[model samples]
Target: MDPSRTLVLNTIIKEKAVFTLFQPIYDLAKRQILGFEALSRGMSGSLLESPDKLFAIASKQERLSELEIICREAAIKQFVSLNLPGKLFLNVSPKALLDPSHPKGETRHLTEVYGLDPKRVVIEVTEQDKVDDANLLLTTITHYRELGFQIAIDDLGAGYSGLRKWSELCPDYVKVDRYFIDHCDQSVVKREFLKSIIELAKATSTQVIAEGIERMEELKLIEQLGIVNAQGFLLAKPTRKPPTELALLKSLHSEVRSSVNQFEQSMAIGWLAKEANAIHECTQCIDAHRLFEQDRKLTSLAVVNDAREPVGLLHRDQLTEVFAAPYGHALFDKKSVIKLMDKQPLVVDEQQELDTVSKQITDHEFDIRRHIIITRDGRYLGLAPLRDILKHITEEKIRHAQHANPLTMLPGNVAINEAIEQRLRSHHDFSLAYIDLNHFKQFNDLYGYASGDSVIKLLAEVTVDVCAQSSSFVGHIGGDDFMVVFDNNDAEVLCHEIITQFELKSKAFFTPEHVSAGGYWATNREGQKQFVPLLTLSIGLVRPDLQHCINSHQVAALATDAKKEAKRYRNSYLFVCNRRKPTVSTVRLENAG
Candidate 1:
């Protein structure tokens, strides 16, 4: 150990010169700041300016606990003074925590002094040093928990015996190290590790927070992996005065708002709920049997509590069989209906999407005979028969099929129009892209209709693959024309990706000579020989003005005008019409040979 560095550390601790910077952690699903992780730094430009050096010096001097306490105090003081929203995560080294000289109840005392809630402060046990006495460390953690502070295991995968510590501690939150999170989107091994962590978290009823997400791809991948909490520089960086609101959070909300199932919004489970008789849980089995016998149409009866909340579901066939068995009536007749009813019946909220409920039923392998108990605010509302749900889903599917394009099997003009109108009615901000193929007719004339069809399919495939990432809806408007309704402002990114992927993939359709020449001889609409360029996409993107656009027709007109503007360019082009302003921006992407 450097004696000079140790002297600097002692002076820093004695002077309480530690500074704290907070980096925000977000709930990706909610698009809101969940909390901030406090990072401590030493005095700037000093020999021990870096936290690593400062702490290393303190550890060698056996003053780590003292430094940690001062750091925590600084972090808590600033966190409360700034009036930051959500929990404050303070890093507490396990070695410091287990130190015999470590102060007890110091964090709770600080919270009390600052008038902050203990529950809102999280003690992040950093795994920087090995703990020789796990029992003692656990005891210290238990003391913090007893004080109402939450516990988190920091840098989980980077630590020794991380899994053992996780199993022993059963921390409320586990922060995966940045090493595993970095470039996770491209690494299958890292992805599998994340998946296993997620599965274990679910099993243990713990929340996983992915750390060090510096790229948008990492954020998207983590969200897709079912991680809700994330912290990274991409979202926001650590600052003494952390921002309460994040501008980047708007994109997360947009993705969520746009991804709402249009079909679910149009047709909710409430529409299928049929009024059915519900019996009290205390009702006798014989009485339920009699009611079923009297009402032949009643396939199942909902068992409710005194509060009218559904407790269980009694299937009529199950009840009838119980009574039909020899001496079965005598044994079960006097018992409460709750005894025979399914204790864990499938219950759904009335406002839930039929498709979502259908998935729940199918995924759980629920018996079709049991009625799906529908509730409004936890009270019994009505019952929906599985057959009714299936029939409605089937009818909707048929309607969708009828309006789908024959070639691409994508939603046709009618469905596209309906989607636009639905978004307008809901007063949602969205962008619509009108896509058309350039020189499609000439290409068809030269290569025959089969190759042209393949090209169209290629565009459809590319559009779907790109837009699907943002939960955007793609529709085949007709012949080489298509449309996409984007819920977020990343339409430009999606458009670029679609064009890039199509350019790369579409090359397979052309002969090497034609690809090299970049043109083919074909007869034009004028019935004269002309040089036709290779296939290129023309996209016109327009953000609809929800206030001015009264219907899909108006939106269509705006998009159509934009499409004409895009077609003016010779290469694959995108014309973005900002309805909020009069300005229009055009991007010309060169066609890939």
Candidate 2:
């Protein structure tokens, strides 16, 4: 053993060395601050050094048990000096705990001294090395648990016997070690293994914390896997710095909220679309051996339906007893899918509440879970596990209120712009129609504006009804004007129909007195009686050929011409078409010109 390691442990035993540090563990579900992990370093030559290096050397030299007791005491002393809101996570060694003679009085004193609840003090048992006596370690852990101190299994994914340790220890928390977390950003194998650990931890009523989160990408990945609680540098690091402006940290989090809200809205639309059979579905049938091969650990196979809808869910845990059954081997070669044999598949309809699905899985209590199929009419559509839906829901909800449209509820300018840009890139044959309502303001003035709003809503209804063709879309661009999109084949016909229905309905908004008076009304803008004719609709329809790579702004501008022409006459319909063949007479006229 190195002379320095010997010196540090000896002084630590005498309570001479002192070094303090903190690492933050987050509440993944609440997306809020949970607590700070209190760490210690031994002091030497009046210089600060990580206790980590010294702790490792002592453990190898048979002095590990002594060093652990002193370090726990020093951490306890420093922790009493400050006041914080969350639990204090303290590190411990499995070997030290197994000794059965180590002093636990100091840890209990910490709870009493700080007036903290014993449950708030989490004792982290890092399996940095394997244990020879598993039963003894479990016995020691149960004692601490009975005292209301939570037990955590640390460095969970690093050790070779991680699975065995998990089964035997059955701790309150399990942290996927840094080794796995380091490559989590890149390695599918590591992520899959971590996911398996999380699933296992959950099965035995243990909460899993994904540690060593160094990047945002990794944070997102783990979050999607249903690992809601985490600890890492990306969260917060320990330092001698005084209690920071920790509360101000919330202001900088606006972006996260906005992002979550937007995600929720998008998820909402997706759920709605799935409910309507506007999305397709697919199923996953990979087995346990396939689990190792693919490096993923999902509980159920996902199945998507013919309507592009997600329908049924298959949970892996449900197969836990069944997969090992006498006939379980057939599932591997069945190829037809396990759902074929499932008497009652776990499923939820698309139109149902997302929470209902969440209550089914991503749920804390590990019920035998599998695919959450999106279904209707007793048929399979698509499958997505509970985790995917939750990650998509929580993160997407951060920015729901921002950039959303108040009217048609499609998406205001932001989403509309994105859709237009996407359409432009795809270069599919589509028509852009600019729909306008004529004589709207005068009707509002005469009907006291409340009735005018009714007119606007009526026009909106007709526009939606007229363009309700399967592939068609309609949007309200604030006040009397709306927009519609469709395939080139029906673009003109849709516009004409919208115009006819719109004009006829516009008359309903007026009073019989106004009808008798030949469409004249007085308005607040100008008290004089203004003669307004019946409403009309003008449509500007543009296909991809109209402007090969027309941008959204250009589409907006070009669609206006057709609208102006449609509104040019008392009641008219105009189609701004890019593919209309010139008439022979017009061709002859052009030749003469």
Candidate 3:
């Protein structure tokens, strides 16, 4: 131990001089603040002003346990006064916890002094240094948990003993090291590693918290990995007091969400026509004619200007027809190929989305048979054949139909599950609405299975019409159950619209007499005769944020909860979990009386 640092440590310890700063940790699934990690800083103008230096100096002076206890004492006092929401993560190390010289019950005593429950405290075992004994450390952590403190393995995957410690300690939380999170969005390897860690944590029933996320992209990546908890400067910097209101964090989340949308849209045209073939505009008609003559496989050619911009398209059949005419070859054989080319060829930017290009082609009506020219920044790249586009569209339609529900032709459970998983993986913001038809079975029993099929089909049409204007994925979960996943923020609005549509359409599903009666006679579940109302729609809408959702199953669970809440009413209703707001429209045909 250095004599000068030892003296400084002794002086600071005797004075009990240190303060704590708290950095807020966010729950991505719940989309709220989960807690704060208490970071200790030394008094100003001291040899150990920063945590690193303070801990180093203490270790050098063989007073590591004493310093840790003092910092814990101060942090606990401040944390209790602040009354922060969520867990308080206090830094601890195996060596410090196992220190023979340290007071045994001081940590528990510290919590008791402030009237804080030990469960609210998480003893974060940092992994900056190697542990001498894994078994001893695991025993110590188990003992701490038994004392009611939660266990967290900090700096996971950042040290030599990382995996081993994770296996041995079996902490409730595992904090991913900053190294893996940095630039994770840009590196496939890092993303895969993070995904593995998340999966591992899930398998072990341990939560993974991604730490040191400073970029919105990194934050999005972690969310995409299905990681529920994250802490970093992007969310909030360390403050003497952690933020209780989360207004600033909410605003930043909005900003990052916008960025994520832009990033996803940046690659609109993915590898669409990179392998297209082209020809020079200045080529002689005779030359193109000769090439076409020599190569029977050459069907069409893209004519480019000097700047490599596609100016026209020439088809072998058209050229052959022109040359086959009397005096056509003699007069135009030596002329430029531009004379025989179609000047108004369909041209599209390479950056244009495939769907937009497809729509353009579809709208052209007459040009569906022609090749679409693709360019990069006005420079010709290649031509996309009509056959390829048609094939691509056909394959997409076939795939959609393969996963479609037989009755409504909407996507089925397989597609819905896939879409949810994809959204979770891509970190796209969306809400899932699980729609169930109330009193559907009774209606089917009163009328026939055929009438029930018609009702299901009608509901499907209403759902499609309601979600038509928005970017949504509507699927059928078989029978009376359906799913609609919305990408926009106005899901609550859409939910109400769907309910209105369903209510309006409900009248057409019933007989005139039944409509007048406002219901039909049916046997109740208790073996009593009763009047059953027309089918009503119950929608359980849940936005799949990082906090409350980790996978498709979790999202389905939330949707189930929302659906249960909505089904509580006899009329069409919408129940949003996060908003805790229910919209019940008393406008159902069954309630017309």
Candidate 4:
């Protein structure tokens, strides 16, 4: 990314320079070797072997021909040496492919010398050098595809116009960028973004692979997000020898499914559950008083109507008058619940929006004050005394609030990841959700610098406050968005809760004028009615099994991958679940070096 590195890439391109360094890509589920992505490192020191610098240089300079040839040759040479049944992803400059001379005769030469299958030799049009002419790039890529070479769009999510570029190029494979993977579990915002990417890849029918997975946490996050192809140190460091074990592959596949189960349990969280007919009804005032004795005073009962449908609520005080008049136990027990029931009680579920809870508390409508519990099916199951549930939720809130976002107080990326990690580590089944906001720049441009900060803080506070009682965690990764951890096992209910809360709270961020205008209205530094930008969120959720995981780091990685899918899927959300770990059950995976 520095000027000097750019110079090196430029020099390498002009000079026909390329050196081959191998990075291992593995199949954790199959425990088989996929192959390597041949990387190009320049000769110059200080700037040499630096991927960022090389990319910047290529983008800045127009001389991409020399670089392309070198990269192809290097990949071919390595592929020939291995002579294995795997693909070699060679990074090629899109600019160079525009010229007829570049790919001509190159196909036969690569196969003849390197023994690589034309179909397996993937030409990755990397983001290092973007496509200036969409038509030209597509035509050039099509030409190579005709020659039996596979096409890949590399580092798509990491760039400014990755989606646009992908649309134009239509590559067979998409490699997500690394920055999004880093610290993914902690920042819900990012997980949302990454999950979008995965969905997009699926829709396009393009295989998605993640690169630069350094830590175990990151890998677990990615796997849980439903990504099957992985390349990172957590799987295995790049080396001369290929992987020879099958256990790795099986482990990888299993871990994905198990993680999902944990998330479901967390979402359906309950200390106790039972049938509606388990309790007796009160008829007399004396009977009500007896039911209210000592520790029993706070019980709230579910009252059903004649047809066995739950129609109202029942509490001890409502029947106190009958209890004082006292009758036989038979009279009291046989009485219908309707007489003592408080008809309009608040009903909620395992997946109720945390913010809805917040709103009810804020309004302080005493009759509606009692919290009712519903099954995953939204059926009335039991009642939650506000005092106790709130006490527990308050503790979670204190913990959640204690960890503030670095840029905004909503909650930092670290806190988000930690909550997910804690849940996954406990192996009780939970989800790590990633939330990322899309197209935030226009807001900054119109509202100026000061207002942008307000937008970010507003998002953080709202997301955090909304998830207060369900023990759902909210974390702000950075910049414009936030994340939420929904632990319910019922996928439908969990997704519903988040979407409902986000839609409602988002309204508060916009002004009345902006809301009516069909877009938002923000003042510029000079104070103008700048058009409000499109506001959307991408979400990815992953659940990793702790018992099978190597360590916390692995779970963190899985969370990050889920985030990548969020971004790729067009500002939407994705869910990835793991059944088991893909590698050995070591507590931690250490760097090979």
Which candidate gets the maximum TM-score versus the true structure? 1
Off by over 4 Å in 3: 1-272, 277-299, 304-311, 316-334, 343-370, 374-381, 512-517, 579-593
Quote each prediction's TM-score: 0.67, 0.48, 0.46, 0.40
Residue 419's lDDT in candidate 4: 64
**Residues forming the 10-long window of minimal summed lDDT in candidate 3:** 584-593
Residue-level lDDT of model 2, residues 1-593, one tens digit each, is 56765665666657656666776677653445566677777675522266667766766777767777667666665666666656778888887777655676657875777567887888898777778887888888888888889888788767768778778767778888888877586998987787777657545757778888878778767765667577777766676433433332343233333322322334431253232111122223344335433545444554444543233334445445555678765654344343433323335444344544455464434333334455443344455555567766666444444644455453445554555556667665667787776677666655677776777778778876776543555666667667666643777777777777776776776677766765774544656655677666667676645344456655555565556666666755676756422222221101110
Q: Regarding lDDT, does 1 or 2 come out ahead? A: 1
Write the residue-wise lDDT of candidate 4 on 328-376 in tens digits.
3445555566555654454444444344444444443344346554443
Which has the better TM-score: candidate 2, or candidate 3?
Answer: 2
Error of 4 at 176 (Å): 1.0
lDDT of 1 by residue, 185-267 (tens): 99999988998897788667678999999999999888666686899999999999998877887765544434545533545
Error of 3 at 499 (Å): 0.6
lDDT per model, in order? Answer: 0.83, 0.61, 0.78, 0.60
Rank all candidate structures by their TM-score, best first, as comma-separated numbers: 1, 2, 3, 4
Encode model 3's per-residue lDDT on 189-213: one tens digit a residue: 9988987886677556687899999
Question: Comparing 2 and 4 by TM-score, which wins?
Answer: 2
